[model samples]
Target: MFDDATPVIRRRSPKSQRRRDGLIQFAHDFTSQNGEDGILRHIFEAVLPPNENGIRHCVDVGAWDGRHLSNTFSLLVGPKHESITIAHDQHNDGSWIGHHDSRSIWRGVLIEADPGKFRELQSLHEPLGNTCLNVAVSSNAVSESSLASILQKSTVQQTLPLDFDFLCIDVDGADYWLLHDVLTNTSYRPKVICIEFNPTMPNDLVYIPPCNDNLRHGASLAALVELAEMHNYLLVETTIYNAFFLPKHLYEQCFQDLVPDTSIEALHETTMVTSLYQLYDGTLKLWGCKKLLWHRLPIEEERFQMLPPSQRNFPFAPNITSTTTEISDPVVDISAYCQSQVTEPLHSRRECSSQLLEQLKSHGFALVHGTGISAQLCRDALRMTHLFLQEADESVRRSCMSIRDRARRGYSPINTENFASLIGEQGPNDLVRKFRIGSESSTESSLLQPNIWPAPSEHWDEETCDEFRSVVEAYYDAICIAANSIVQCICDGLLQEDEGLAASLDFLSSSNSQQSSNQRNGIPTTGLAHKTSILTLLGYQTGSRHTKKHHKKKRAVHPLVAAHTDVGVITVLLYDSGDCAVLQRQVSNSESDKGKFKDVVLPYPVPDDPIFVVNIADCLSALSHDTLPSTIHRVVPAEGSIPRNCLALFVGFDPDQELKLKEGKTVSYETWRKDRIAESQKVLRNRMSVSKS
Candidate 1:
């Protein structure tokens, strides 16, 4: 109904002619609603006469629920108009954050992703040629060449030469990563670009000043932006919700059209009041032509007071002067820079949770927390991880020297299926190599496959390899992120010993950035960081190893011992990827089925149901946060089988550390077992041998 939304955008009035009042109203309406940066907001703004070239070629990244698409399209095609084919990632999705109906194109080809959901969604959108990928978007470390879709049926990739009058990219969280991996790497560059309003999105969320996930300095909003000008793009437009980049040709035409006739100057405030915010219908809107005013809500006002005046907005700075405080856009030394930022103290629990979640989603949930994992999720993560590690080239894993057990296949989970797929399609030797992934236990002297463990070897190198890896990786990442969720739940005073305890909000600061790199690289830090992350996330001050463990050489130190009390108050441990072993001594008489009853007891017997998920690694997080015992623990050595390599998250609690002599009642483990002292001496002697030998 409204096709004329583009041409007259900024055409000038002739010198001999006086402009009509309608033109003024039109420009005013355009600037007031649609904004000068060339975003399509409302129909009234789109209806404003365009010069010659109409709006064409658009891209919106982080297009949460396609709200921006709906709003922008309304300006071009009228509120109720249908859309036309615009080239985009055929499997792109925006449903998790919000929902928007597909207008122009087919129902949007995305992977149905599951046995059930895939079937359901496929049935629902079969009319749209079965758009919508059901498979999860994995971490983006992978390149297009390594796609897991090559052999998968029902998978369709978008072929280029796919012309589009408009383009929108709304891939959320991974904006920067996606920018580098996809848009910049691809041949497609549009007349306009719409980037999502991520906290770390390029222009606005460039670089949050290096703090522990806190918004201490808003530098994270703008990084290497000046360098972007070299990329044939400049930070020409910005909004609180989205940013726009105009091609040089579009810039000239816009200015030429607005020449002598319009009162606006070059990139001048267009009297547009909106920024990267939302439209009337709650869709995100970006950069305004007119400057928007602000109201500091009580919360905002308080935040403003907390921050220094200099850190606040520019009001508008045509050019930001380079000063001592001005962060130089140096080539970021990834290792050094990452370390420096992580060294800073953390923010409150809310800040930490928010930032971590953003990071997880940004990295396509690449990491797994050692603590706070549900048993089933943890098992699934482990199964997936083992597959990736086993399938990878042996040379790669050994060269990398598989550190602590966190990384599976030496890369993030998102890249797994593709790698597995890569190995799967290769020649026989390569296939045998990939399939041999957990076939032989390095721990065992025998070159024998363990029972019930050959499936990964059998399928890892098969044609459907990458697809399986993709499926497994999702489960792995979900558990890792979920671990943090559990931690957050606890720190907010949710993981309580008192079931009747009312919920309380405790604001805890951000702790250091604990990377997997930290763990695999060291034995001590693995256990320490895992423990500290949980406590830190729970609002504790275990910030930077406030306590130190010192070993005095040549000095006598005695083993600290205490008689068992009801397992004392609780402690928690988070695992990365390895296992933890808890050894206990029991007399021969403390027996179950003629075997030694465990000195260390499990809360419950292991479940036999195949679907049952019991992650021994996350056993620590499962313990109540209070009144748990301070059990003796140490890292299980990293020898293959003889040494028993495993991921262990331990929770130790001490209600009281005072001495108690168990004189009357037979000792717990000894109650049923016999020859307690002799057995104890034998176990201790064996441990001593391992320690010395």
Candidate 2:
């Protein structure tokens, strides 16, 4: 607080810096505070002087319940907290009880604008003898006076000292303004400050005052840095939401040993121990500071070990070098690369209830031994697929061609070799009919959209169309039923605790109250209609006897579908084709980050032992934070003249709800879906323009 001179940080060699960064990435010593609550521990441990004990004092603005997602929790009561302690017969919280003797002593003042949350916050810190205020905080003179008065009263009443050790400001609105006022008008200066930073704001160092509650509300990173400098603080670490800063004096003294030099070169370079981890349903985040040493715990060490050797290598070099032992007859074990983490699929739904939960956690996808999905129904569905593409009249097939803006829906025949190589045979041979099933509105309140049933054609026999509709619809319903169970299995896997599951289900149910029962149910249905789940009928024509074989036979012989990950949560593949391949990434030390793809044959579904192959997709991986692997798979051209017919179902999250992550970061499914669609359209437009030229 007394220092006017810039702090000097210790300088380390490049090799030493790299080694220190590696240790932090491997150890999980401190968890992510902004993303979870681990990063705060790193911040506190780094700034506070060694051997200093007992509450230095902290103030948390916009403190909700003082525990869940709180940045000051680690400093207030210590990290390892238990509700029930046998040694100390204390009230629920072990604040003044069992572990208080060895506890890192600390006290805090929690302020929340919401009356209800403030009450809960008070109850949570009741045993700690900390003050919890329910009044709103603002930069206005009246609000500033009231806030100053509260601080004055707390200091006198509790006989606590002034000049807080830590300050956490995180009100949803006017966060920047209130923080600015505190720095400029108050005599209090926190040794360390953890405040919310707006990610949506432009990175340029401009300060935008909050006037509308609807807009993203927080100070920009550059703006916060400027503000902290004005208050004699040095910006230390920037997490997903919060920015950590240290008083200049504290920075020069306590942090020099851990933090690297703050020179221009060190500031611009990303030599800090940074990490990108997906919080539970949260946005992917980068963690750690360049200057501060990043500490890793045992759990993170185990996580690194689980990675392929290439990823596990130190220095994180793109081209990693490793020695290999050659085998007499090398045979790539496909199972080793893409098989379920578990040994076997569940035999029944009951088994799915018990075992699939563990499998989803480990493998991300599982095979059900007995799904009860009728093989005959699937065959009939395949027959309908064949009739729509090959047997149907020319006008009937043309009628289903997608219109101007609805390319994702209706019928689309493969035209280019790229399309053919990705999902079907080259040329206009492959026909796909995409049907949306459920409610029509794709808003936050309603994720369901009415199904766009294919119109009956006059050229086709009316009786045959009716029969086709009946059979296909029945099969669709059956797939939904099985998929629902799969969805439940995923929910169980993703949300292990009952409370987490209940909260998710409650959100889903409340969001779709006006929609059908299926909509209310937490099912994976997204990526198409930007909300509605998709059911596609794939008809890949290898060739027929009457078809011309001369011009380009290479198109048919090449990989029918190129390697790609599914866009949705999970994909249910139902087909009798033996000519498909699952593309599993094979990482080599010599290869770049994106490893080469290895293809393995996808076996045909046995008639007697009918099994539907379900693969975890991109949406689920994002939702699950990569806990489940999103299987990358593709179809290969059939060997015979008969066309390969298959049905695929893509399920995802409800569009209306935003993925609530730690540190107030959120991602809207609908927004992400729209962006993906826009990107795809741009690619298609460029491809079409090139072809026309």
Candidate 3:
């Protein structure tokens, strides 16, 4: 089966200069032919032990142009080439094996369907004694026969533990089926597998048949993981559109405690960038794991620029270049400018209500200085968050992901990790630590879901685990108390006959009474009412390269949170770093100050003080009919290696409850909330559809 003629390659000097002018000479050689050279190198280094010597064979399916973006390039031309030998073998048993050479044998079979590319591949590797075939790999017996013939010729099957070193599958349309057939029907399984995944689709376990060329060209990570498990493999790493799987037996020896169990939580500990969507069949689809397309592919950059503000998948906000100087003279103390009221200690309980209301009505936001919240409470929450995310193994954190509770009410890793491989910038994992103080469901028909949590043993000792739970619960109670006081203050300031706020207060009081009564009477209850609020503990890591270079505001801005108004009634934010919370005055479209509001950067509060930035939300603003503007604010991502943390208490009411308003007006908060959420979801859906198209 071997071709008689030897093909020659056109090689250039390592330091050769391009003949641009044909006059003067410079001493810089061209970059390598392989665009994915570095990534492949890193992957091999991780899989292969440091100083061992043996034959390393690989199979490159869809091996177009051989060295161009070839996953097996490093094995052929890297600095370790001298240690490797190459040859070809045709045994008496009618079997064919790609040849091998010296100290460390390196040989590979490159399969290319396109005739021109196959010729190029043959020419590139013929001199090295490797094999290149012009054939399409498929689930059909004919396609597999080529591989079966070659595998039997080699002693690779006898090389137990590592049948072959690496296998790269990239057939574009039928990769999943091909890999499945190879693993299930044949004995040649590589120690390491690098397969292309569908970056445009969701991460659901969806597999498309090879004949379905009209659908997505690749399989989802879910599908791949299922296949891997069936074939005695485990996913170890994921690039933009590629997943790396190693033999299940080899993972423990290579990575060990580096990777936790294969839970979604463990996966997130490695990277936080994900593109999520839901298919019509009700299965959630996801794309982009570890590396986002924004970094992996250049084509995404062009598309990202074309997306509108509402449709764009920004980690935070856009148009942050608007300056504060245009809206107001830079105030040294933004807290003073906001005219915040001191409502802590409850001092008289009823005495400080008016001051809180006036400040809220005038500035749209205010700093509430109180004794209820302490540094220790904030630290406890942040410490637990860091311990779960940074200190624990990735798998431990992944174990906490609750697919059923998609609002992700516990330890959720939101989009925080950078597309480091693509963008050359890597940041710490950004975990959105969530804790619920009340029921998650709104209606009676819905079952109330308890908070999702990580397994205690996954991260800490039993003693520390008990303390973690206690401290978090204590902080939850403290924030709830502080937030309740602010709600009462709002009720006192805005309503003449505040029955709605009184009813809410009554509900809380009666629920506590019922719980106490139930415990006293030995009757079981859900503890709190069917409606409650949430406290979001966020770790905003340093800004990514895109935010740093593109989104710098007059004041620093975090991309994790962008220029948008809060969705709830009121957001009580505890800022832990620099003047991170920036607020802009709401200017009506008819006013001269219309667009000018974008310029104002709300000033920072006194550092290390127990100052809670209380900002009014859309619900209150909608109820007031723009009389009380919902301030537009954003958290500017901190720069450099310095990470920032914040605790925000979102005060909300029963969605089903109707609001009693001024002039005998009545409104259902649920209706308005649904409309807003629907509109945003529509925009995002449209964007995803258009992007895929």
Candidate 4:
């Protein structure tokens, strides 16, 4: 819930009524926008009235020439000043002046990084008795160039009050970081603050670009609001480029009766950016400006054509329409299919394989029952994962960070991955914690990294830790068996359709020459052996109470995982029963059905049988020459849904195996994997670093 209270009856005080009715009449701007000059004048009248002979102080970072787009200039030099030319020969000797009223003087400290602009700023402000500093401000607390340190070096330090009346931060890049550092590292709590926000960003998005001085992209309004709330500030107003905030106590004292709606959505008035929509048919549509000012990328085209191409559109199964009817026919009886391989006739075996392949080709995913994994095993795995994630100490989890093991192993805390970036979108990080279990390598020189396990701690005993490892390994092995059988079934079905097509995928079969070579080299030769064939145990916990309250609103859907396609050949997902975790987009040719993402349902023929949902991944689409296409899927919090636990098995190919593609060109699996991983990791590292800083 928001901190600002909505009054039952909207009533304004005499001063509040006067401020509102006269805002437009008195709206005179030296540099401020959106009538901020008038608003600040009214605010100061209530907080530190000019008639009361009260001295006021204000600080402005990135104050270029102290007038260009400056929010505090009108307060320092009275709003009535029209055009007072700055003299370059004016003495730097600080001369005191009362600009607003003869009885009270406004003291200011204006800091600018550009030398040329700082000189102009000094010429304009030094004669008016304001301190002008030519120094770049950093967020680093210990640095001499930090805002706190620079404030102390200002010429008006002796006269400056501990708690200034107002502070303006307009550094284009890392504005949020600089403001956060000043609030957290210093004792100065300004009554009013104004900071710039990226107007091109959607109001709902909370994005902060990497903390690099060279990058000028500012933080989103929502990001600033979240930070303000943490510092006990309430967002009161926003212009096209800047947002204004006041401390909660001050807002209640000064403007509670004036500002009717203090909610972020109500306060933000800028709507310059377009919404990016991913249609159900895989088309990307931009409804407004295509240029991303933050990234400096111009999208000349209005619409991106459907991905995976129309030629690759698989015929939908008779029962698998674009409806949430809970069709049960997509669940392939894998145990029966495997039993037919040895006991039934060859035709029967072929029929089952064909059914399994049809489900994958039609829906881009299929739920398989009887994968040699038991329901109890899945429950135990989930139980252990929950225990480990909930009981482990913070230090224990940090010690097992995934990046310590080539980003493939160990415990990954919540929000560690940003799936949206994988698809060139910007949003919050995925809210899933994971612990990965990798295949055991036979040789010491193998490229496979060893999985990291948590040691016994006060949270859990040594016995519990050992039991956790055993249960997780068992679940991983079981899923690997199911994944291998699924891959072979697809291969068999492909052979029936086109032998040449299936022959191209011979390396994926366990009995192929590639497996024999891997065995001779003491490498993992399983049907889906690769460094990325990982079994990841995932846990999604309910977020903060405030977040839960927000999501509970009607028709509000919060994404647990942003829309993305898997990176490997195929992925096998097993989730706890009764949890609606995954939703698959309906890729169809019908325009009416576009933009619909239906919940994936696992049909259980028997009560105790284990069902595993399997989906085609990017690598398989490439290796199959687009005969099969990957699907875009995401996880959202289901209504009345509790915290969920799930397992994902990403089956990939051997690192050294060369995969031939549509063209004559061939690329090793390692090279392809690294390219994709690098792109996502670059974004992830930048996001993680910004969050930490």
Taken over the whole model, the C-alpha lDDT of each candidate is 0.28, 0.52, 0.52, 0.68
Q: What's the alpha carbon RMSD for model 4?
A: 17.9
Name the runs in model 3 displaced over 4 angstroms.
1-351, 416-448, 496-530, 543-558, 578-609, 660-668, 682-693
Candidate 1 per-residue C-alpha lDDT over 1-693 given as tens digits, one digit per residue, 9 for 90 to 100: 446643333335324332333122222121112232223331113322332333232332222223233323333322232343332232122211121222333223333224564564444344434234444333243533211221123333342222333344333333344344334444545444444333323322335233221222222224424324445544444334444444445545553343323221122222322335433322333443322132222222212122122112233334332222211111111111112334634434434434333322221111222232344443443344343443344443333222333121222221122211111111111001111111113342221222111123333455345544443334333322333333343333332324332221121112212335442212223211222121100001111122233556443221111112111112222222221122232222113422222322221111111111111121122232222212222221121111111122212111111211222232222221223334444665666678789
| lDDT of predicted model 2 | 0.52
Q: Candidate 1 versus the native: TM-score?
A: 0.25
**Candidate 4 lDDT over residue span 194-219, tens digit each:** 88888878777899777666676789
**Model 4 segments beyond 4 Å from truth?**
1-329, 336-340, 391-396, 403-406, 442-447, 510-525, 529-532, 544-558, 578-582, 586-594, 603-606, 677-693
Model 2 C-alpha lDDT per residue in residues 482-597, reported as the tens digit of each score: 56556555555455534443433343333322234343224322222224556676666543322334775533333455545666667776654422222233231133524344
lDDT of 3 at 528: 30
Candidate 1 least-lDDT 10 residues: 534-543
Choose 2 or 3, whichever is better by TM-score.
3
Top-scoring candidate (lDDT)? 4
Per-residue CA lDDT of model 3 for 381-448, tens digit only, reads 65564454434566665666656654425656656322111111223333233333333454442223
Q: What's the TM-score of every candidate structure?
A: 0.25, 0.39, 0.41, 0.47
Of 1 and 3, the candidate ahead on lDDT is 3
Clashes of 1: 97
Range of the 10 consecutive residues with the lowest summed lDDT in candidate 2 = 328-337
- Residue 256 lDDT in model 4? 73
